[model samples]
Structure formats: C-alpha cells, structure tokens
Target: MTSTPISKISSGVSRRNFLRTGAIGGFLLATGSATAMLTGCAKSVPASDRLFLREQDVVVLTALIPIVLADALPTGEARAAAVTRTLAAIDGFVGNTSPAVMDQLYQLFDLLSLPPARVAAAGLWSDWPNASEKDLLAFLTRWQHSSVGLFRAGYAGLVKIITAGWYLLPESWPAIGYVAPVRVV
Candidate 1:
C-alpha cells in the first residue's frame, strides 16, 4: 500500500470537481449535524395548524443557514450604508408576502433583523454568481417574498432550520438585533 503524490491526485480529479464535491460533502455533514442537534425537529416548532414545507424547501433552507451565519456582514458604516442601499436588505426577504405573512414578517423584522425565514431569503439573494452590489440588492428585494407565501400557507419549517443552526453553533448568532421588533404606527 502507498499514498498517491499530490500532483498525481490533481491529475485524476480536476480542481473544479474536487472543490465542488468537497463543498457538497461538507454541506451534507453540516445538515446531518444540524438535524442531530435538533434531536426532534418537527417537535420544536409545534404550531399544529401551520402548513409544512416541501422536502426541497427544507433542504435548501437548512443548507443555506451555515453559509449565512458563516459569512460576516461587513462592519461599521459600510454595512449600515449597504443596508440603506438595499432598502435595509429586508426588501429582498419581504416580497410578495401574503397579507398574513407580510404582517407577521413586518412584526418579526421589528423584533429581529434576520429571522430564520429571512435568512433563507438572504440565501436566495446571493444565488447568482458574482452578483453586483446593485444586482445583489435587487435579488434580495425581489425574491425575499418567496417564503412569505409559504409561511402564509402555514409552513413554519423555517423556524426549525434557524433554531437548529442556533443550537448547533451558539456562536453563530449575529451581533445585530436582527430579531428586535420595531413599532409602526
């Protein structure tokens, strides 16, 4: 038995493929660990009447989280300015919301700057490759409403993903008051 040389390994696996597979593997591991952290996911947010998410939504959601938490938003004035430039970034996560979800989301925003559902929306906001600062803001505004419809339909699944990540990595919590409620007249 012998180990392959580094150059030989590179020849067999294209660097691009290697990176992609490694990312996917890490994703799966994180998802598994998050699920394990929750112990019983369905039991956590037991709003019995709420609609459930499709499997695809759940997968996209749980996976999006670590990356979101992992990416540090630029600090200080730069971040504050970015927030205004993107309409406070909530524009992306608050779109086409059901009246019910819209109202609830508004409340949630008032409370917390980045609730789990909005985190999923923020994930979608960055889906495009090399999205421009303007394009990024646009994406954040337009698609943020997606999960709102899902929420209005009674699927509170986003809550589970959020709490799962929070529990798995306590340190991932943001320094900002993303969850603090604001009073509107």
Candidate 2:
C-alpha cells in the first residue's frame, strides 16, 4: 500500500474555508451588480429643481405613505391627491429644517434609493410601484419591532414624517376629526 504525504493528501484550504471565500466573493459580485443596476435605473433629477427632496426621495415617500397611514389613507383619486399634497408638504417641511437634519434625510433617501440597501434596510426588493400593501406593512412592522435601535429609529422617523405631512394638509383635517381653530377678526 502506498501512503500519500499529508501535504499532498489534502489541499491547504479546507472545504469550509473555500465555501466562505466563495460566499464572500459572491456577495460582493451581487452587491456590485445591484448597485450598477440601481444606478442605471435611477431617474436623473436636476440639482436646481430639488429644494430638499429629490425625485427618488419622493418616490420612496409616496410608496410608503399609504402603507404607513394604512386605513387612514383615502381610496382612489382621493388617495392620489392626498399623496401629492402630502409630498409637497413634506418637501416644504424638509426645506425649512436645519441643514444637519436635511443632510440626514438626504443620506437616508440616497441609501434607500440603492436597490441592495433598500432590500437590506427596508426589506423591499422590487420598485415601490410593484410592491404590495402587505409587503410594505410587513417591512414597516419588522423595522418598528426590530431589536436594533437604528431600525426602530427608521420606523419612527418615517412614520412621524409621513403622518405629520399628511395631517398638515387642510383636506386631511376632516379625516382625522381635527377641527381648525376659529379665527377672531
């Protein structure tokens, strides 16, 4: 019987190590591809046109508002109008905020705009238009209920902004049963 030397018997790298390396490489490749695809898919927003929120930012918010508001959001054309008005309100509010706050919002929006980041952070893989109400609600619930502080903060921040912006619209007041204060001459 011939005995094979230990060095020659097996390769230096174990199967586990090989798999680990492959997995890391695969992840990097996938991430890069997703980034490229997302970048290509992004609509170019003119710098001058953006006051506080970019087009992508609006997309994220519009997709999320209905889910965040759920039953509170009206149906059909009213919902469409509400989304538009609320987005405008959010834009105005964002513009008025301090530069630091605005920067944070921009960062968050940019992060969400990336496909991989959106999937990892928001648990959303498809475009907002393609996402179902159930999926959106699930994502929100996960973030809200997550053990991580960052996820909790993300949930709180999004909910606060969407709800606040929506309620700020005069049309939304009646829905929420908030009567406007009487004005004295």
Candidate 3:
C-alpha cells in the first residue's frame, strides 16, 4: 500500500491537526465575525423571550438537548415539554452568567451555528436542524475525547450546561432521585 508523504501530511490540515493547533476558536471567530458583519449577526439583539440565545442558537441547542440529555430526557409526549423547560433553563443559565462567560458562550454558539465553522470545527456537514442524532453524538464524543484541550473544555462545558438545564427542571428530579426540599417557615 502506498503511504502518504510526510510533507503532504504536514502541509494538509485535517480536523485533528487543525484542532491540535488550538486555533479553531480563532479561525471560527474570524470567520464568524465576517459572517456576522455581512449578515447583521453582530448587531443581533435577543428578543424579550430569550435573554441571550438567539433563535438560531435555540435551534442548535434544541438539537443538542435530546442527544446530551438522552436517558435523563423523558420520552413520548413529556419529551417536548421537558425540552422546552430545559431550553428555558439553559437560557436562564446563560443569561444570568457573568458577562465574560456569557460572551464565551455566545462565541461557542456562533461557532456551532455557522455552517462553515460547524463543518470545519465540528465535522457537522448538515445544519443543526437537519443533522442526524448519530452524527451529533459522534461530534460530541469526538470532542469529549479529543487530544486538544480546547475541544475537551468545550465538550465539558456543553455537557455541564445541558445537564444543568435538565436537572433544573422539577419534573426531571424523579429520574435522578432528587426531591425538592420543603421549606419551613
């Protein structure tokens, strides 16, 4: 079997190598900034319904919610309600965070929401709405075990945020054996 040349391997940027360089964020920021400028995303102000996450960001998070919360997420009819509640929770969590942290989350959301960044950074070729659950899971798994620290951190942050949203729902407590504490006057 023929092998790839060292020069070629070094010159060509694969997702792994690209992630290893720790420049994916910078690349995404630059591209996202340009896209934002052209598309008016830079001036996107959140509506009263949502504090920070925009509609596109909500779409991205909606796709992520089920996958990340899988078992903890209720099935059947309850699933929709749980997802809505979780979205609200996530919105509150992101909205109430420190400005710096909130800004970082916006950057992450922008990276995921942009088509080019989604494909290049996360290997998601389809838009968040059209992406298969399996594909999304693979992306999450890859980032979870990635050699790059940034990806690992991103994965951790995502999982933490998603789960926090899920657990914050009172209905989800039964699954995790958490009972709401009664307050005594």
Candidate 4:
C-alpha cells in the first residue's frame, strides 16, 4: 500500500476500507485507487460495520464544517486543530480512519455541530460508572427527543467513522450489536 503522512489516520485502515479525509474543497480520498467518490459504496469497510464513520465519512464531516463554521471558518487556516484532535481521540478509540470516511464524517458533523454529536454520543458516555444511570438515561431520553436528526446523524456518522478508522487495524473487525435506539427504527 502507498504511504500516508499521518500514522494515527492510516495505521488503522484495512483492505476493506474505502475511507478518505481532507477539506471539502480540497479533499484527497484514496482507497488504493484514485477513483471518483461522488457515487458508489467505495467498497464496504465492513458490511455490518457499526458506531464509526470511515474516511469517506470524513467527506461529510469536512464539508459540514464549512457549513457549521460558515459564521466563523477558523482564522488563518488553523481551523481549530483541537476539533481535529477531539475527533481524532474519538476516532482513535472508535478506530475508523479512512480518508474517504473521514471526509464523510466531517460532512456529517459540519451539517450539525458539537452539541449534536455529543448528544448522540451520549450513549457511549452514559455507561459511566460514577454517574447515576437513571439520571443519565433520563437526560439521554430528553436529549434524544430534542435532537432526533442529531442523534440519527451521530449514530450514522459514527458508524462510518469507526469503519474507516479501523480500516488498518490488524486484529480489528466490524463491531456488532451496537444498536443505536431509533437509528434502526
């Protein structure tokens, strides 16, 4: 396989992955082939992949950012590196870092925002040991009610995120049974 500049991003990908990552305007997606990604599945990172957005998802994410930040598109090209870092953290943990997947995920987020992703991600966070599960679920339910789109996007986006992110991990496989409530329904 051809070499990539970033390790955290490339190290996790697999042959199954068809992910890409870059700015919406200048995104560079390569899934072992320089094919156009406007259409087609780009090959499934994993058919039953769940809870992560892959490189292609990054397309959605990067594009969404321009929309999200239309009011304030980060000064001097820094583009809030922290946001990338935060995404990287979650992406690393979730493990879907394909270039295409990354772009798609960014579009998903750009369409929404931190509040929405965080809200959808609540399920992941809700299982915290210290907090009262009752209160958390209650809050999650309420949060769910408020941001159905956010919740949906989060789950969908996360699925793409993890799939592309884990494209390269040696022992990795698509996660199963991570059913996001209402996501299926």
Question: Of the candidates shown, which would achieve the greatest TM-score relative to the real structure?
Answer: 3
- Write model 3 residue lDDT over 4-83, tens digit each, in one string: 85645864656667655567556657887787667765655665699877887789889999999898777899898888
Give the top-scoring candidate (lDDT): 3
**lDDT for model 3:** 0.82
lDDT per residue as tens, model 4, 1-185: 97654544745643333232122112312321123233334343521343354554444444333333333334555555523533454546544356675555444433223233323334333223333546444543543453334444455554444344333332222333333345453
Give the per-residue lDDT digits (tens) of candidate 2, residues 54-155: 777888888899888877878988888888888888888878889788765655666566777778667788987788988888988988886545567667
**lDDT by residue for model 1 (22-42), tens:** 675455334434543454332
Model 4 TM: 0.25
Candidate 2: global Cα-lDDT? 0.74
- How many pairs of residues collide in model 4? 70
Q: On a 0 to 100 scale, what is the lDDT of residue 180 in model 4?
A: 39
Q: 11 in model 3: Cα distance from truth in Å?
A: 24
TM-scores, all models, native as reference? 0.21, 0.72, 0.83, 0.25
lDDT of 2 at 109: 68
- Global Cα lDDT for candidate 1: 0.37
RMSD of each: 17.7, 10.9, 6.0, 21.7
